[model samples]
Target: MLKDRRILITGGAGFIGSNLAEYLKESNDLVVLDDFSLGKKENLSGLDVEIISASILDDSALNSIEDVDVVFHLAAVPGVQDSIERPLETSMTNFIGTVKILEMMRKKDIPSIIFASSCAVYGNTEKVPVDESTCPEPLSPYASQKLASENMIKNYREIYGIKGISARFFNVYGPKQDPNSEYSAVIPKFIRRCIEEKSPVIYGDGKQTRDFVYVKDLVRALSLIAEKLPDEHVFNIGSGVETSINELAETIINETGCGKEPEYREKRAGEVERSLADIGHIKGLGWKPEYSLKDGIKETIEWMRRSR
Candidate 1:
């Protein structure tokens, strides 16, 4: 049923968005709208994609695109550290931008939308495998913005009848991820540093753990979730397993055969010490992560090595 539908993937030139676009474009009519702030144009190469170079906050830009059946809202100023330095930009793009998208959806009468929320909303909760029932305690401005967006989306679903699903992503990594980005995730940054034979940098004691979900797995889960339009609007998308930063660095080093040592820096503020998701909800939607961290990291390193 999702096939042949006209889909809009905002931030479509980005790592996750581009991968999702590549996977769906073969089956669905995919239109990509991106401002190219964090997204890269090269990611869209070799694919016959309809590209609209603009921000989701642009009313004129959002208004310009029409006839959309479903929208995957991936446009935002991403990352915890990035948001810390520029709260206004993060709030504007992540929160205000989501409002604009929802308004556009309401105006266009697009009945369903999939928003890119984050597990960062869980904050530093002691619960190892936090579920949707766990109250969100967002520590950073970015996390707060995502939570606020989720509430607005849920409100729209109730009052306006929009099938809005908020997907709270864990640490995601894959081929198209930009390691050079100032706010790059640990996996991609670690992979690139390892490939360059540079010692991977770890913030703080390096024991802070994260549940890493492979990008392809996330893309598949999003597709399955879209097919069902599940009863609940919130889901934690990740591998149920957790890996510590120290262990993660070790694995990356062994995989890439890069420098064996790692340098430790002060842990960035608002970083959760531990985060793992209970995937029972998403699993009931008929999807599970196919890639293990080891396997996923190997593939990621292979791609980075080749691309470099």
Candidate 2:
């Protein structure tokens, strides 16, 4: 569906973005905009595309692109703990940056956009599997900003007639997820610590449950959304399977063959107790996640082992 199409992917050097870029580059004319702040350039090392080393916060970066068919907006400061420490920066990047992109899209009259939103926007919901109908009660600044961004996108679509889809991603993990960063996701952090023979640290009782989706599955979903732009649509992109942090640690330990246990730490503030997605909307669109948690973890562990 992406054949000979002009596409712009913000944050295209990050884990999820790079995966989408790589998958689309074979058939689409790709342009990547990333400042290399959190996203590493090495993630896009072998990809054949136009690389613009710029931040989404910069208007010039948005102005540089022209006549793009689809803009996969994925650029943002991601993480609850990180957002707690730097709320202003997180708001600027996630909220203001989204506004900037929407304004540029409005000016250029871009037909469609597939925004990469998050399940964090749901906060600690009474609902087990959050769907698009769930009322968003964002608990952290990061979640608030992402929710705000989604609202902005909806507003733009309503007022400006710019068609789009907001895909609320669950806990995504796979190859190219930055393991060395302090703000890395739980799975990568645990895998790296285990590979280094260091004790993997777990906050709280390691009972916090999350739906972990593979990067490849997420990329495919994004591609599908881009190809088929359902007017003002919002879909939960996830595997619909919840795994506790304790189980995730055990699985990683087994896969890595490290035989190491995770060290317990006090729970961080604003951490969600559970998160799972009701992906019925996306499934009705004829898309479903292919990777199981165990298979995705095994692949991620293999990548970590090779990287080290």
Candidate 3:
């Protein structure tokens, strides 16, 4: 509920960006810039705001973002598989686009930014519950680019006195998540399959654990971070509960009242065996997950059913 503030969300047409737009639109004057490569305009259908359908790499387009108080930089090429398949494009857009955004912020004297980083930057760390202290050993091109952007943001903060918070998001899911994408996460896919009474597909023995954070909870946390402007810039946004892929599939089936087992497939590459977040840093900001995994799943199922 940040009122009377001029805010800009870079990838505001994507799942997380659209959700953030919904959460903040009522109180703030919002502007969104997205190239429509991964984000769709329909995501912003109901909102009253200015939409600039252009890539962040376009300097002229970025000039329009001047006079904004805060920038929620969420635009990027988002996936390990996609990054692997197209490393040059991923690096070009994710890294260069961020650098360009930083340059624009410097030119515009933008005060604060909430950057959408990733747990993928932690990569296959040989530790449980990865924290901000963990050295990022990125395995994919996507993760490397994200790390590069985080470093840029941090450096900009240190040198320019601009408050920048890099939120490392976990497996985010909810309504408006496009299950049709090849790079979509497990929850949306699972719920979609369960709605159709089909077996959810599981990869890598289904024992791979992930820290799932509901979209609503995440946006709430993000809004809190934007409000707080904490000194601790990097924080992990997660549910603090780790659920394995098999258990997640089973939960989806049960939630949908489907008595079906998940279909298991070979493990994927460039993914950690277990992924969890040490949220001690973010908790210090007075943020917490408001939705339990069960309730979140229920809401997600309801959304999937309605959207279909």
Name the best candidate (by lDDT).
Answer: 1
* Cα lDDT of model 2 by residue, 1-308, tens digit: 56789999999998899999999999999999888888988888888989989989888777888889889999888877889899998899899999998999999989888899998888889879888898898888988998888888889888998887889999899999998787788889898888887878999999999999999998988888888787647889999998999999998888888877889999988678888999889887788889988899988888877877
Report the C-alpha displacement of residue 242, candidate 1, in angstroms: 0.7
Model 3 residue 198 CA deviation (Å) reads 0.9
What is candidate 1's CA lDDT for residue 100? 93
User: In candidate 2, which residue ranges exceed 4 Å CA deviation?
Assistant: none
Model 1 residue pairs with clashes = none
Number of clashes in model 3? 0
- For model 1, the stretches where C-alpha displacement exceeds 4 angstroms are none
Identify the superior model by lDDT, candidate 2 or candidate 3: 3
Instruction: Give Cα distance to truth, residue 185, candidate 2, Å.
Output: 0.6
Tens digits of per-residue lDDT, candidate 1, 62-164, equal 8898899999999888887788888998899999999899999999999899999999898888877999999998988999999999999999999999999
Which 10-residue span in candidate 3 carries the lowest summed lDDT?
A: 263-272
The TM-score between candidate 1 and the true structure equals 0.96
Native-referenced Cα lDDT, model 1: 0.91
Taken over the whole model, the C-alpha lDDT of each candidate is 0.91, 0.88, 0.89
